[model samples]
Target: KVLRLWLFCQNVSFMAAGVAVVAILAYPDGAMAYNHTPFICLVVLINVCGALGSLSTLAGTILIEREWAVVISEGEHPSFLAKMNSILRRIDLSCKLLAPVVTGFIISFVSLVASAVTLALWNILSVILQYWLLMSVYNGIPVLSRRGRFADESERVGFVSLESYSGWMNGLVDHPYVSAWRLYLKQDVVIPGVALALLYFTVLSFGTLMTATLEWEGVPTFVIGLGRGLSAVIGIGATFSYPVLESRISSLRAGLWSIWSQWSCLLLCMGSIWVKERVSSAYMLMGGVAASRLGLWMFDLAVIQQMQ
Candidate 1:
């Protein structure tokens, strides 16, 4: 079971790395040029890679559960079909309760590709904002922890010890399954998303600077190519940093708080967008967004400190 899980996790990691590579390679002139053929081919490849990666992860988890069930049901002479049916029944129940998990994976995969394409179009800032919102929701609420529920008759509010908290967090950090998710979050999701955003900004900044410095007909294209190269480098760097960042933040709850604060700021920005009309009015709204993102990070830090 451990070996299977490890292999599955490795496959997902490779797939994510491939996506990052593809994004870098399929830059404006190479894959996304207004020319139809290359763009279509690249798009198909991206979709295939992402879909396969997600399915593999999902399938691996299901298999692990099945194995556990089989072990626990020792000596039961259930037929293959009966076993399959039993598994499916459990899956159905899970799907009903956790419908959003499936949806979240799908959305995350789709948005990743879309963000890459958007960056190709030189819409960097917009792509960044879109991903920031999506991931904030993914990591902050449903994925990291479940919604808070009222305490029940059997449940009591009690002081949790620092030692206990440390042990729990350490187990989460050391466990392969938990580590896989953390790697996915930091390397596959956050890094790629941030790289795309940075690429967009880099291209936009270059274009702005060049427009100010010199006259050119194809400056945007130049910016796109340069940004793509930079993004590739960022992707590579992120791959290397994944373990380091995970180790650093594993025990530090501050990082989680930062994420939460950022999410709150994101919500504020969304609300501001709905209420404010004028461009001039967006400054305060933008501040709110920054504050929220910062707040999440702070909250994560606080949690880590408490655990410590």
Candidate 2:
């Protein structure tokens, strides 16, 4: 029931996002050339849509990939879980690499309006296919359907619960969202989760900051895109390598290896900071960031399997 409700909400949100994007591009003159009020309103609407899409994606990932994977792999050997996790990561990375290239090609050659239309259409159409796929998976897997409710009666509470709080301070601490964080913090896997998050926070990847910095240093767009593509390739390689390494050494050791390898590659980036030459520093920074993806992804896979 929860899954169905979430899926329904995501479908509505995706369609709304599509409509908002189309509306933005429908202007006769470009947004900046025309009145600012409508432009601001459209921007806010799209931002909200994007946020909702992100949340929906996150929720769907947790539901299908993490929870369902565990349910299906129950009583199976750990390698089964590892394989499932790796395959999903591989597909995810592939899509991440391909989607941008495809979209960029369209935007560069076709038109921005066309690209917006394509995006809106994709959001509208893909939701139907995604819903079908998810439902089919649930139906096909008997164990998934057999799984009982995760939340206990004790876990359920109103958003504003007067009874649970004995004092004013208790109310703040005992808030449901706060309680969820408290429970997560107590888990053994929290360290691995933190490690994963730290990797995300790092600037070594092909993030917007590094891309802008490289461009500012007079690096060509082609080189930047090439470096980003290479990073994706390296990350894909990690997905392949993780299973073999895990079979030899356990997940924990694999994680250690991956993290150390990432740190070692990132040394180039640190060295770049000290370089006197601007262009050289940018290239060095880009190289370090690209190479680090290998370890970063392997470490990511290792952490996920550990959690599972």
Candidate 3:
């Protein structure tokens, strides 16, 4: 089970590296030249690679959180599991914020192909680190301790988990023992999940295009990078307030409020794009972007808490 989980995590990140490496090879002009066929191909490949990586990681997280949370929280005080999950969420948020800054800094200094190569090397090292970590810390990280591998929780979350949808159709469908919707997707759960997912998709999927739009409006690359970094900083800062908000209202309610707020900010962000050739317009756009991230993080914490 540990090996399977590791493989899923490994492939997700490894294929992300593949996405970058493929772009380096397939893009005739740099990625900046978006109107070309190769660029379109790059975008399609990236989305596909990113989706597979995400699905695998999500499956791993489900297995870990559901099965291992009990293990970690056992004999612990109230809210211990919750707080640990929060820490994990914050770690993911930090990565989202820092990645663009790191990538931009590298791209600013290096050739495009060189930067892609660097990204690929980074992912390779990450895979090696993951294995080393599995040996040293089991599945759990070594946050503040050094101890048989902390704990692995190597048991499968369930057998159904190992089977991909394609395999499920081929093997599980209509078999005497088979079932439909073995895992129920309740409407309440689905709605917030979709909302949270769409927010993430909007920010991530249109990111390159948004940057390009800013460039078209005369924004410098470093300036755009700075803006993204700022957005992340704002998101991180907003996370600290989630507890306060949850205390005042239900988590789902707080999440709904955040979703509404983000849409409002998105309108303002769109408006900023029309302010052509003005220096303040760039700042305006940055402000909008930061607002969106703030709403996003707030809603993210809220929904996840409610789900848990």
Candidate 4:
């Protein structure tokens, strides 16, 4: 239960920290008016915030999903899990589409700081929602809150020291995080899956570079955000199409499509490196950005299908 609470807190805190970084980055003129050092630091801080938020959300969500998987499984309902999973994917895609475009519109029409403030307020609202849902669902109590769990048995487990707790958690090497890495090392199929993961994210790393380069180039924030948002909109179909793909083809086979799609489409943007015109280069970059995202979402679907 402590672990669960810690995860949830980290989840909220990560998001809060991320938005705070955005607040720092809401420079109206694109690049900061000050020295490059502060700008670089803020950029690095935002990247850190993004990584932390993503990892924490991934870990917490995976933990919760496994709990749900136990209670609601294919054994009980044939298509229920798949249907719910597809629905969740749709919701996630919808958010992805909405957030950026909305942010773009705000930054276009309003002050940069206003956009940040809006995001911050939304996150605060989420914190409240998160608290409400948790409290209602579990009575805001630990899982092992029953009398027996707190009973004065021979091995009383009421409280534990920090060091003891750390040791205990470390003892659970079979935990998902640990086991996943172990499986990746021991299993041959997992290597290609990992490679696929690497390839997809590596391509999408360009998205970060694209953001920085474009911001540096003085591209309007709204245009940059809109282009990225539209690309995500285009990729939604690809994301939701994975289940149907699994029905028709083997997951392993389908996963290869993830790799093939991006590498192929990205070829169109190869000339961006050599192009001198800022406008042409900007178009090329947008093409690469969109193509990169399209492949990534498909890779996400393939990963869950085959790797998991």
**lDDT of the structure predicted as candidate 1:** 0.42
What are the per-residue Cα lDDT tens digits for candidate 4 across 132-230? 775565554445233453244223322233354466585665365665566456655676667765764554433667778777776776677767777
Number of the top-ranking candidate, with lDDT as the measure: 2
lDDT of 3 by residue, 98-189 (tens): 77767777777876666677766776677677667654644354432333342442232123543455665756653434432332243347
Question: What lDDT tens digits, residue by residue, belong to model 1 across residues 173-207?
Answer: 56657644554454424553453344234312223
Best-first order by lDDT: 2, 3, 4, 1
Order of all candidates by TM-score, from best down to worst? Answer: 2, 4, 3, 1
Instruction: Report the Cα lDDT for candidate 3.
Output: 0.65
lDDT (C-alpha, whole model) for all candidates: 0.42, 0.82, 0.65, 0.62
For model 4, what is the error of residue 273's alpha carbon versus the real structure, in angstroms, after optimal superposition? Answer: 3.2
- TM-scores, all models, native as reference: 0.24, 0.88, 0.64, 0.65
The per-prediction CA RMSD against the true structure, in angstroms, equals: 20.9, 3.7, 8.0, 8.3
Of candidates 3 and 2, the better by lDDT: 2
| Candidate 1 minimal-lDDT segment of 10 residues | 299-308
Model 2 reaches what TM-score against the true structure? 0.88
Task: List clashing residue pairs in candidate 2.
Answer: none
**Runs with alpha carbons beyond 4 Å of true place in candidate 2:** 5-15, 30-34, 147-175
